[model samples]
Target: MLNIGVIGAGRMGLNHSRNLRQLDTIKLAGVYDILPEKATAYANEFGAKIYQSPEELINAKDIGLIIITSPTYCHIEALRIALDAHKPIFCEKPLCRTQEELDELIPLITNYDNFFALGFVRRYSPNFAKMKEVVDSGELGKLLCGEIRCLHGRYVRMHGDWFADYDKCGGVMLDMLAHHVDLQNHLIGEAESIYAQSFMLNQNEDELPFDYVSATARFKNGFISNIQCSWLRNAPSDTEMTICGDKASITFSDSKGLLLTKGGKTEKIPVDEAALNIHKIQGGMYAEEMAYIVDAVINGKKPLAGAKEAIDAMTFCFGMMTSAETGELVKF
Candidate 1:
């Protein structure tokens, strides 16, 4: 069995533990968090051990894989510790707060023959994957444009002060929209140029961070795309994407499943029963991603989403943040 150690017993971390418990091929060896109670809670519930420190978890002889769901700031050091041990790592997205950190860590990763996968769960969504296949197969007939709209109630402010801080979370663009940026790259291509606008509606003037953002970009493949993200909405949470092509259009909504429009006719694409089962939980993608990493480590295969793809997506996100601030098109 693949022994997995999870660092951070917070919401995402605990979810990982639960999923790992359900996978027969994997074992939840241990977990660690700065908060003793948090770690203890997960360990007791999952029947795994709790370590006093991240170092202990990393140095554990039985832990072949380390899943880092710690805060964004801790990602660099946490990943470094795992890399030094030559342990395979599956890190959460927005890898770090700055490009310089990624610059320093990229070399360390290149030096070791280790498996690394970033958590871009949307890529694992079967509906999105099938949409990509359709677009790539010429079935969609040369993608013309796409738009992704994601809106969630402003529960983030309730989490903590750090979440509302732009420097920490990189605002709505980096923290939330980064997923769509990665998805866009996965489906369309690298963005050539981007323009963005952002605001802080219903927030105090002293907030010093944006709560909503909308960006438009031109892709290298000659496709134009628009992305809208907001944490200020008071309505039911909704996320939807529409991709238009020469021959057809594909639409996906988090609430509704998938739909296809072609030749003046619209039809619902029947949801895959297996994929639906996988999408039932937040941990589904996490488990599948870890499984992919395990395969790569054991079989000498490449990860579904490698570091290069992650870096490209982050670059696009950072560029959008810059564009929003400068009111000008930023080119990659």
Candidate 2:
């Protein structure tokens, strides 16, 4: 069994723990969180040991894999520890809060030979994977412009939660939209330029750092892409994206399988959920991503998403943030 240690016991961390527990080839060996009670809670529920610090957990002899699901700012430290120990790692998305930090860490990461994967779960979703295959097969003809939209109800952060702070989470741009940004980069190409703007809708005493962002990017492949994300006080939660090519267009979501529009007709491409077997796990996308990294670690297989893509996505996200902050287009 591939023994794994987890850093952080929050929502995403707990979700990872539950998914790790479901995998037969992986064992939840230990967990550490800044809060002692949180670590204790996770350890008791998952039947793993509780370590006093991240240093101790990553250094544990039994932990062959380290899963870092801590806050965005905390990822660098945990990653450094895991890299130093030469342990394979799976870290949550938006690798870090800033471009400078990510750039500094990239060289250090290049020195390690161990496996490193990022949690861009959409790549693991069956519907999206099929869409990628169809797009890459030239079935859609030459790809053109695309649109990605994600919206969620008011994200009122806890009193001291870093997620509510722009310095820590980079707001919706990093915490939420980074997933689609990564997907766009994967499906389209590297972003060449970006223009964006944001709004802080919550004007109350308990204000959020950043709320809504609308941006457009031009890809190196000569395709234009638009993205809009929001965390309004009262709004519906939805995520959907569409890509249009010369001959056809593809669209996908959790609710909608995959749709292709071609020759003046729309068709739904059937996705074999049973064959994917991701439905067998109760933890949803988190479970699928966790299982993917576990398989990669044990079998010496390359993961669908890893550190390079994660860094690229973060680079795009930070560019968008810079554009919004300066009210000007950012060029790469």
Which candidate wins on lDDT? 2
User: Each model's TM-score, in the order given?
Assistant: 0.89, 0.94
Cα shift from native, residue 162, model 2 (Å): 1.9
Which candidate ranks first by TM-score, i.e. highest?
Answer: 2
By summed lDDT, the worst window of 10 consecutive residues in model 2 runs over 200-209
Q: Which lDDT values do the candidates have, in the order given?
A: 0.78, 0.84
Candidate RMSDs in Å, in order, are: 2.9, 2.0
lDDT of 2 by residue, 154-180 (tens): 566653567766778888888889898
lDDT by residue (82-126, candidate 1, tens digit) is: 988988888888777766777787777656677887888777777
TM-score of 1: 0.89
Off by over 4 Å in 1: 110-112, 154-156, 200-210, 276-287, 294-299
Clashing pairs in 2: none
